[model samples]
Target: MDVTYPSSLALALFSITLVLALFVRSLRSKKTKGQLPPGPKGWPIIGNLFQMVMNRPTHEWFHRVMADMQTEIACFRFARVHVVVVTSSEIAREVLREKDEALANRAEAYSIDLISHGYHGISFSAYGEGWKLSKKVMVTKLMSPTTLNNTLVSRTMEADNIVTYIFNLCQSGSMKKPINVRDATLTYSHAVMMRMMFGQRHFDEPAEDGGLGPKEKEHMDAIYRALDCLFGFSVADYLPFLRGWNIEGEEEEVRGAVDIINKCNDPMIRERMHLWREKGGKEKEEDWLDIVITLKDDQGMPLLTFEEIRAFCKDVNVATIDNTMNNVEWTIAEMLNHPDILKKALDELDTIVGKDRLVQESDLCKLNYIKACSRETFRLHPPNAFLPPHGAREDTTLAGYFIPKGSQILVSRPGLGRNRKMWSEPDAYKPERHLDDYSRDSMGVSMLEPDMRFVIFSTGRRGCPGTKIGATMIIMLLARLLQGFDWSLPPGASQVELVANNSNLFMAKPLLASAKPRLAPGLYPKIQV
Candidate 1:
């Protein structure tokens, strides 16, 4: 039988034993040779766990503590684990770049382990040969420039579809009605990923208004739920013995979301695998699924196992959807609040792409101001408060501080973007700040920030491999929306509310804005199929 919660007597006994064990270990442990970063003092056994618990959103709490200490880097201990939080680009580089080899591993967590199929996926896997092989396959076979270029037609089609959808929404009522920017952006991002992955947009019938169908909505909802649980801080992660107890209900939520995701994805993957193995592989590769399925090793056998393929599919789905959607949503909201910025972006698009045609991926190079707006959004409002924590593979010194083996190094997203030392008036949103001394040919605006000023796509050993495609998707989405239509706030609202959600960095409320077609009637492409 499974016990959801322990009996009072049993719980009391366990707590006593845990405290005593920790006390004894603290007394017996030897002092380290070097200094650790400064942080708040804690109780005997629990360390800073209670302080963290009292703080509702842990990321905010961490930032406040670091600010109070007036330190760029700080450390906190949660049941013997040393978590080093970095708010400085210098320290971030020191950990992720200078000592990359020594800190290449990923910290083990319960939700990540469950979702990744015991670390079978690339993103959260431990640093080892398995990770290397998976990254090589992902980079070379799926996300390389050559492959992405080959798949351009699919992305182009979705770009056209977004314009068509928005045009339809604008025309629905005699007068313009407020459209849900969040819904439209999510649908577009989802459609692009689906077309590239499965060669089709919908599992069943398509929604008439270019929104998600029932099946698509269910699948996307599950994906977001899984992301929330994966990034959330779990008590069981700190206390390994309480993993299955479901004390916080995180385990159950993760299991349910994973079940939904598998139900939607596994059948399709299995059917395709059967088509390749039982029947014969397709004569022509149609989509990414075919490309991954047809990959062969030196001995003329399947390169990856079924589990690995499924895990990869899931990873791509999770990674592709969130950042692009959130960035576009945030950018649009910001522009509406600052109409001057919106006008500047519109002027740039009109000057480069012209009003006679829709913005194409090829036009992205010349649109420096548009690219700056995107960069500004990334710097001000990242999707997550922190990048996924990088774990240390061995004991090392970082910025003259001793980092014990198994320590987790967290890079703050807002901390770097708003670091007073790196950016002047860091809290303000100014796209021109990125345009200073910017050259379209030499620098050529893209989502990557190699200098570690602000992270769009990270760098180093465990950096994102899909930067080329990712940059294309972001720029295209924003460009099309700006080029094809005119956007404004709803009737009564004076300005867009830029408050971020407590759990994550997404807008607390979905953005509702009025849109009117800004181009010739013939410009918007009709939806095919």
Candidate 2:
């Protein structure tokens, strides 16, 4: 009787589990690539998704596939969607430069829509008038030198605060404790971008009112999740016929992410608009929000809805801000790795900036090594390994291959940064590559424009409009930090093996950097030149 009862209970549990498993399995059905693009072979229903993501630096695996295929560019099939892997600078130029107008548009992927609130922002918007107008507004009005200077003042103020925080942190604990440079950089950048767009960096002070508030942090977290998940093979993105493929928790994550972003940003936008009405002066006297709000000539139509304004703010905050900060962090890491390069930069900076005054825009000209270090850093670790996907507005062909309308075109930035064909000793961190006076002359620019082959900020119409300001910000921060302290890898840290494995954030950062303070008398001292 006991044996019979136990067997019966086991059979009941198995039956229940099997039924639930079958029900869950029924939720998804695989689709065919048909005429999409040529790529690696994969398992059914989930095609090529798992293999691409199983490892970090997702680009490396794809690079190996490119190597095996003997092709500079190839396409991968994720269910039915096409993902093109580009690995050449000439092809990159064709996509980003020559035929740019025909290729300036972005693919309307589902995850971007959810993370970006229905693809409403400029960074990921489809090629159209709205995107064009917003991009122009940023380039001409918001990202101008005058506006950047105003933002710089805010940045300097924040930097001073950061210095105080670091000093206090040192006083309390071991100064050698390695802080996540990504977090610190974000703190710096969020403050700058906030001031640029909204006349403030954060909603409330973290120390006084709590860092970014719990709600704000949650919202920022959603933004981060949105960024982290923005690009990847999503089953739901490809097999739309099956509207519910929760592979790797991607579907649920993106939907949850959208709700999080809206909750965080929508309220702030509402309050900002109300404040603008009450103040009733130059709506755009000092901020991007003011500029858009002040526009009476918005074609006599409602110029911008709160949704559009929110998208604009998100574009600057989420897209470009972190890109600049991460670039700075990577530069710092690379310089630390190469001592000779660091010393060269210090000597150059000491000449121009001296030891008592801060680095100024005027001094950027004489500080050649400092500028070279910036280029070398970008060479080592570009912000976006792959440029954002650009959709073909019309059908085009490259190398006797047809690129149909909607085919995704991307500039292989990371690969290009490391290409031996374009760079000598590609993996080695050497800033002297740009120091050739002839190299600088051949480039037909000052220390300002870097080697075009290393397109950290990209090029052409879609190239980062804020490139100059972004570069200046990185230079200033690095100059200030280097002047303030002689940074190095922390005790017992592997200097050689320390690679930036920051594949998880919106911008890639150095996952490992250990150093203690080497306080100097002056931070960002005056440039003697």
Q: Cα deviation of 510 in candidate 1 (Å)?
A: 0.8
- Candidate 2 lowest-lDDT run of ten: 1-10
Best by TM-score: 1
Candidate 1 — which residues are off by over 4 angstroms?
1-30, 440-443
Write down the worst ten-residue block by lDDT for model 1. 1-10
lDDT agreement of model 2 with the native: 0.62
Residue-wise C-alpha lDDT for candidate 1, range 181-279, written one tens digit per residue: 999899889999998888889877888777788988888988888888766766567767767776656788778888888887788789898999889
Give candidate 2 regions above 4 Å deviation: 1-58, 206-220, 242-245, 277-284, 298-301, 437-452, 494-496, 502-529
Full-model lDDT for every candidate: 0.84, 0.62
Q: After superposition, how far is residue 38 of candidate 1 from its true place, in Å?
A: 1.0
Error of 1 at 101 (Å): 1.5
Backbone clashes in model 1, listed as residue pairs:
none
- Residue-level lDDT of model 2, residues 41-158, one tens digit each, is 8755445655654543466777788778777777765543456767777777677767888887876656776655667767878778878877877787778878776666666766
Clashes of 2: 17
